[model samples]
Target chain A: MFPGKYQAVHAAALTVVLLALAASGVQAFIFSDPGSLYTAAIPDSWIYQAYHSTDQLAVFYGEGDWDLLYFEGLGKVADQSVRELAERSLALYGEPGGLSGFQLETPLLPVEVGGLQGLACAYTYQDERGNLLWEYRIFLLLPDGEGFSIALGSNGPWVKNNPPVLEEVLKKWQWTD
Target chain B: MAVDRLRKLSAWVIVLLFFSVIAAPVQASAASSGKAGAARFERALGGGAVPEILKQYGGEYVLPLGQRLWVEEVFRRLVGAAERQDVEYTLTVLNSAELNAFALPGGYVFITRGLVNAIGRDEAKLAAVLGHEIAHIEEKHGMNAVLRQMGLTVLLEVGMLAVDFASADLLRLAGTTLLELISRGWGREAEFEADLVGQTLAVRAGFDGSGAVSLLDGVLNLDSEDLPMKVFRTHPDTQERRERLEANLASFWPPPAAVDDPQVLERLNGGRILAQAGRNDPRGRYIVSLQENGAGLHIFDLQLGESALWLEGASVRDFAWSPQGQYLAVTLDEVSGDAVWICDRWGHVKRQIDLGRRRASQLSWSPEGKQLALLISDSGSQGILVTYAEADALVPMAADLGVEYSTWLEDGLFIFTGDAWYCISPPPVVPVTVQNPVPQVLQRQRILSPTVIKEGSTIRLTRPSLTMP
Candidate 1:
């Protein structure tokens, strides 16, 4: 075989291998729940945990390691304001059965949830078994009195430094109902 | 020359990507079919081994001979009514306080003691729970996970839950522990089907189908707070299960006079304990610990050895069981600031009292189990406050904040503060706080803790052994 032909063949094979690796690793995705409870553009490489997911909860893990993202749909929080719900949620998260060592990273702010007016708060906690640093974002939807949260817990520092993948997720998230 | 090489590379990449999509081993969200359905499921994990492993997770409760006969008889009747008669079903009672019932392949149906206690004497409710498990086994839902990724990381947690669909899923869950899987749920569609079939079997077995409703109601009682919580996190989510079952069974809806006397079969099976608040309610079988590091309070069933309730926010500085072992007083470490929670037998927090800037310790219940006496240490001094666990404020024996002493008067129990000794029962001689008498009357029947006596302005008491501070 000619050296030029050999170089082209080698280049082609390498391209295919890299493409396969990318497909198995950081793949593009969309999640549509069977019950039509939710539809969202899942963050790249995030594996949706269907068994753990429920009508009220959608759990996703990213980074091929453990960058956890939880989309929890808390229905009809009565007459409480988003801020109040955020406080109660923090309290619940700080309760005995909830996350460990949940400390507020910052005061709650008004933000957008799937493009809705919502209350946003950031807190840090160790996992239930007193595991690694877990930072969580609570988004209480002002409309419908419903709320969802996006929490990112990690055992590695890479996830903390990377721009949150949830930015794309929330940008594409939509309520099917 | 470079452009020509890039074109060749691009052509190969596009062709490879096209084939990958077609050949990808990813499972579709839909229920699989054809050969996938017919494939041999769990050659080793399928049969009796699954139940034994489950029994290891949820330890077995060997019932008394007569009571065992009654439950077995109930199981036999339900088995008689079920459609799949080939599978010989066996019922194993689990010594767990969590309201749970699960079926393993090979007809092994397990029910927890919590369900038994919650159902009390209602054989029908027991039948409803047992029937659900039986339906799961008969439908083959219990054994239907085919091998996937045959060479992947197999997490046989306790040599349980390995190399199958659940374990296959486990490969992706880098963060999900077995506790999270169990705490969240198994699945929904299969669970809902089990409910329908289970209720049908129960009705066919001469038990009221509404027993499913009452049985779920008991779960609601334990899980009402929507605590995304540890308790009553059923396979299909409890509230939805009840609604779905109710909608499906709407024709005969609530069977007339279905308000069953749950106490009837209860007494026949040798007297189950009904929780009368403020006394030693025998409903508590799970023991709790602020496991060594003191950050999380894990409630472990004495018999099951499984941690059912995991309370994990701050260090549990102190904890004490009520005199009757019906309630627990837990003082959380001040990482969340000072507070004490009055929790039920199952360790679900019934009430949380914010202790301002001060901290509390030595959580012990007062005699007769009506009030909790905890030593509250403020910035200045530490003093004992006798608080009625039901109310937020301490029910002052008189007007002062501290319980100087406590005694059993002829009429009732009296606690002395700096001002006066107030009688707390046979109607309080000087009731300073609003008293709810029902539980107090029940507690008056017996001395649950060792003893307590009130002196002029001082009291000495001995608490139950497991008091933590």
Candidate 2:
């Protein structure tokens, strides 16, 4: 094809793509930790926070904790197998503290992420203020009693709708050594 | 003789008519006095007024067993400190959160839960409150209002003080009239006198004189919009009261050095971190856990002036340093479950206490650091469980109290069952019924054994053997 004809076709395609993107109303951006630990494409509409003065790599993506995605490097409080950790976590949440309205939505299930084995579960509960919250937690075991966890919290419908942000983050994760 | 008899009859008619005319207005005045009339009649009749007062004020609020004992203990101490030779004071904690503190002529003192919460765990401030009410009684500030309002003068003047003049209507009229008068508070002079006398009483009761000053400061610092104590309009002049108390304290021969800890403010600041100083530490090193990044529980040993991130990756709910500052017990909420892991200052896990099937809500250190008191609960059972700090020994200390609050008690630990204070340490070896003390200041203070409470909500604290004075 001639150069002028090719330019005409390309501009038309670009315009259609831009219009489709505008219509979708979903936007995401790549987030990389300042320490160059890892990076992931996260929803731009959700809040993304990183606590710099922390030993654990605690990061949050949510609306002021009410609805959000959270990631943390939970240091070893106990030396246990991945299955043992999963069981204990389930039990921990099932019991009462400030959470009086706690219920298990789904049993723990083994899953694989980033070439590592981990456990994931979904649950529903009311916080101290009695705001009904739905949460999905994933715990990944690391070497030397170290573990990594990611929590996603929102209303039940959003959580049950396969939380798009969690799927996107998992799909776009980029770890740097 | 007939003429003399006629003269005598006429004289008898005149005397009878004279007394009737004089008594009619006095009776009308007494009748129109309303609740004051009812209260006066009740007082003269010599039945209890506390029940009537409580009935009007939403009944009595039964604090947890352990807390009730603590209040009673405070009342007893205040009584002994004041050295009153007569007039037994009944301390009744009315079930209102209106920040009211008032006294009745019958040595009855009432304080609201709102005032108690405002005081926090400061017993000295609580004494300051009680002492103020005591002053109202001591100075007969409320009594003058009581007599004029309750029509006691009417009865006294007519010489009907011993008459059974109270009707059902009079009894119904007793509460709100007196309640309204007390809630409005005594006049300016009476309040100032109460403040001065109350401070002295609290100081004599072994509390630091600064408690009154601190309490006043707290009131002044309250949100200007909500302005807690100011709602009663009693201490609306918070700044003025503080200045007056401070000046009076300066006049004291030797001012008290009792200063309140400013840590509750820290606790109230979103509670993002758990920071606490050791009970018996001389160096005043505080251990704080930072949740930033879930990086780990960093033991910030501010004593060495070093911020150390010793532990990592554990979700910490709460933690307490041992008495000797030798051991730190941190409650962890982890995927492996909620557990209390005891660590040393050197970052070593000494003991991991996981109460299977039961959750440990609070951990308090013994003064000696030899043991730790854990407020543990399950779906059905709630109590204080004492465990050897470094040992694997777990002893059920008190199964009678724990509605999810706990604190330290001089040589032992006190746990709140939300409604009662239960002693957890020393295990109460001697169980004594000790005839329920209807201590003055607590006119309607009823010590109901958990078994006596028929309420399904409160019956859970069945400490059949738990008897505390």
Candidate 3:
């Protein structure tokens, strides 16, 4: 026997649950845009910034000291592996001024991302003012030899403090297709 | 309608089974791929038989349990510090009395017990040696050499087979090739690369960055006819490598100011010892030296003409006497983990600290004698920590100078050697000061050795007086 008061309560609970589900659906749709070729889990705390290029996206987080960069592009140079291309691109962008302090903390090692073989490296360098910064770069090779590179850069202290969160985000990264 | 529903149900079941069959294996393969590759590599290298084969050579020594643990701990720390978690390293000690260390593919590193004994149980030297071998593995020198010997088609086939790869014929060929490479060593370029890589790892692991240089010096001092003379053949041109390493070290971390005039110090040699403190006490002097067999430490009282055995049984790696001559800090070599003993002048152990399976080499007593400064290796977690040891507290100084040698100044400050001579105030506050304010010039002049001289109630440091431009 469903009392009138109980029936009203059940209907309200159902509506609330449906609304929550719809809200999450909307959030996922917004993050995984249909036009984008890749999708990754970004922490709710991060603020989405402008896309630098058609293939590159940047997001800022953590007291304005850290940012996550994503890039996907076809092979521009001939006869180079995804690892080489990624390293070359990183060296160009990471050390634009040909700085001397750039060091690879972790060499290019095998990694599995989005169920595909990938390569990853961690590097550290000092700015002109001598502030230590670290970056972890992971590159996933595509079937057509295109590559997707993800970079997480921040001060040393912040990266050390957020290992688990960073690992989770990398674990959830995937190709949209 | 019933027939149609049954057909739909059967199709759904078939599709579900297909997904399960495909997905389960893929997940399993992904989980076990790395382990399987490692296992295959191990099998190809003859598994446990590799150590036995190495023991066939005369003078091979099996490490005691404690020493084994110590070696493993050090290796683990080095690998972790290098951030190379992909390869699993297995360290083996040959019981032979040969000063040699080498690496094999599949994470196998071998160091002779004689080599450890020869280096006087110095941990930094050990780290440098281990780091060099590890660099060989990380850089894939052995594997690349083998692959070059064999064709690329074989490697491709081996790669394709993955976990189920090992072939007996291929293993035999690979094993023979590895042995040849080990005997002949990698190319000069590879060796140089290994030296740089090893130095980087050793420095990063909080070891004395000069460890590689020290090891090379020791090697150079060895008799040409020694059994370890094979090192010359395997590692060609030691003097050149040493020079390169010295240059690299200087660039990476500049040398501290010279503590003594090399010309003046070079003239006198006989009775003078490398005393850490009390260089100017004319009335009497204390000198610490290794026993004839390098088994223990001997403290000689020059004034009294008496010598006392400070520590015996284990090799004395390093030691320091307090400024006031009240206490002595001595480090003992072990296969497990080295121990640092705080003892009185009469050789009575007051406090013993176990460094848990890694090397604790450099020790410096605070000027006031209330605290002892220790250069402790942090493996990979932190570089080296300059720890202040008091009666019941072990406080780590916040300075990250990668201190190689440290001494406490009379003014309650500590001078540590890293890129240069930098002074830091004692904890609970550590403020750093560079001894020389001038920008370092890249000249290759021989540095003066630091000496403490006393003149009329004043302590004087007789270091090389450099004219700043």
Candidate 4:
């Protein structure tokens, strides 16, 4: 009868601690968030309306993160033609996301999209804002017309200060005609 | 304390050993998967397709040796002769000793110097060869071979991998073994069909179909000892067929009238025959231009546009662009003796490769730009396609196409259109194992038209209408 009091007390404490741990684990599992982004295409045209809040980019001809060939084919020429368009476009408008007053470097990778026809490009250009913006750009020539697209996102300490919401929303903007 | 430490270490070792045993099989499976993937890739690229590969060896550059100007003139004449038939062509003379000829993917025809020399100045024999090569193209033999090759490669790789041979080395070994097994899959029927088609074409183009018989006779006599083996290995039985051809002189339509023109004969003979060729030196990718006269040619480029230059006129025609763009020498042609010029994309002279007296005719460059092929031709014996470098001439690429008037599509690939037989190269030496088999063959579409524009990046040619009865 004297030993029974200590055993009962130990069992009660163990049960309380176990319940707390299980509850905490369940809460974490239910509320933790994962990161992802994607786009949906509409009918009758090759335009895509993105549906995410993070910086989004895509390649139509070549692969890798920094490809501009998908945008170039919108201009109508296929294959290495995208590279030429990208180079020429960069020369006309400077860099798409850097502060070097539009200084865009040519693509370093061999990624292409839409068969073996288009190449990709990645660059940095300065936006209207004096602040430097890093942008992912693409060059493509579609059956309809030539096109160039830019995705501007904040980089460095600035990105942590202001999230890429504007750039994320703009990813949906594309030429339909 | 020491004993306790020793026990702990032993326990750790046991755990490590257990993991190794458990993971080894999985790692092996992963390695096998990589190999399987590689094999599939190789097959897709047609890298291990031996007959196709052999047919392509040293076939990318134009031979810049011999009387290049005269050869060009001969080609121009052939173009004129083809005007009536409304067929456009691309020609290349290969530098090799084997008496062979072939048509390639797209409209490409190659002839070897050996065939040229053996046939001598016989215009009829040359016409026969041209007709046969053109017939192969008309029947789409090259395309068939390519399609079959690609399909076989995929099936073979997938089938082998399914059988658990998943190692990369296994895939490679399987590919090699399969290549040897699949060499020269074209059989007798295709050869006969090509022969018939060639004969018909000769008659349509105003040449005597008897030329076919004469050309065959020349080929038989030139390599009489090996004719049976060659015919048996690559074609169906020919004795009865030859007899039929010999006896049925009435069946072969005659040239409606006795209109004789040496220039027409020369054009047909010089341009169409002995034009099997290719390039060396890790030859770059080829861009082909098919003209109305049923004549076509492949030009190698560096960065495209005006910057591109034609690597023509070396007696050996041995240098070509590699993937990284290197050059090598392979064969020697007799016409390479004259001054040869490398033309820019605009056909302007860029550089010269000279061979004093020995004329070069057949030329090819490797796709990787690491090797070159040259064929030497003369009045003596037909020349051979030799592999070489700037100074060192290596072994012959193969003996199927000759070097006279030729062009290359890429390294290891060419069109040998010569002397009544349009043949692919590296000689797909079939062994005596398979039963009556339908060997794969190459075929292409023949466009008969006249080119009118030569400016810009495109050419417009008037399509010719065929009045088939």
The predictions' CA RMSDs to the true structure, in order, are 33.8, 24.1, 28.2, 31.4
What's the TM-score of candidate 2 when only chain A is evaluated? 0.75
Q: Please list the residue runs of candidate 4 whose C-alpha ends up more than 4 Å from where it truly belongs after superposition.
A: A1-177, B1-88, B145-185, B222-233, B247-249, B252-469
Task: Compose the digit string of candidate 2's lDDT tens values, residues B1-469.
Answer: 9999999887656545533543454454554545454445534322345777687678777653335656766777777767545556778877888776777754788888777666666676787788888887777676555444555445556766432234443333334455556656666777888888988877776665566776765666567687545334854466676677766653333211221235532332333222343422333655566566664666556646667665676777766777677777777666656677888755578778776667786677767666677777777777766665533445564564434555554535554444444443342211111122211100101233444444311234442221111
Candidate 2: stretches off by over 4 Å: A1-177, B1-49, B148-180, B228-231, B254-469
> Candidate 4: DockQ?
0.01
For each candidate in turn, the interface RMSD (Å) is 20.9, 21.5, 22.7, 25.2
Docking class of 2: incorrect
Identify the CAPRI category of the predicted complex in candidate 4: incorrect
Candidate 4 per-residue C-alpha lDDT over B1-469 given as tens digits, one digit per residue, 9 for 90 to 100 = 9999999887656545533543444345654445444334333323344345346444433332222223333344334344223234666666666666665433456666556555554444565676666666566554345434333333334553232233354445345543543336344566677777666655554444565665554444455566423223554545544544444433441211221355544444454533323232223434433222322233544435433323333233332332343332222334435433333334333344455674555445544333344555445434443332222222333233443333333312333334322222221111111111111101111233444776334465542221100
| Runs off by more than 4 Å, candidate 1 | A1-177, B1-44, B48-58, B145-185, B223-231, B250-469
lDDT of 1 at B40: 29
Q: For residues A1-177, write the lDDT of model 3, one tens digit per residue.
A: 569889999999999999997665322212453346666666555545442233333343333433443333433243246676556645543442333366777777877776777777776766545666676767665676554565566666445333654665666767777
Candidate 4, residue B346: the lDDT equals 40
Count of backbone clashes for each model?
5, 30, 13, 186
TM-score of each: 0.30, 0.35, 0.37, 0.26
TM-score of 1: 0.30
lDDT of 1 by residue, B1-469 (tens): 9999999887656535533442233334224423232222322234425444456546677653334545776788789888864566777787777666777555767777766666666676778888988887777664432111121222222332223332233223311232233333335787888898998887777665656776775567764664332334557678788776655543332211111234532332232221232223345655565578877676666555566545676567667677667677788866558888887766677778778777775555655555675556666554545555543334322223454444332334444444433444422111111111000000010123545756322365643211100
DockQ of each: 0.01, 0.01, 0.01, 0.01
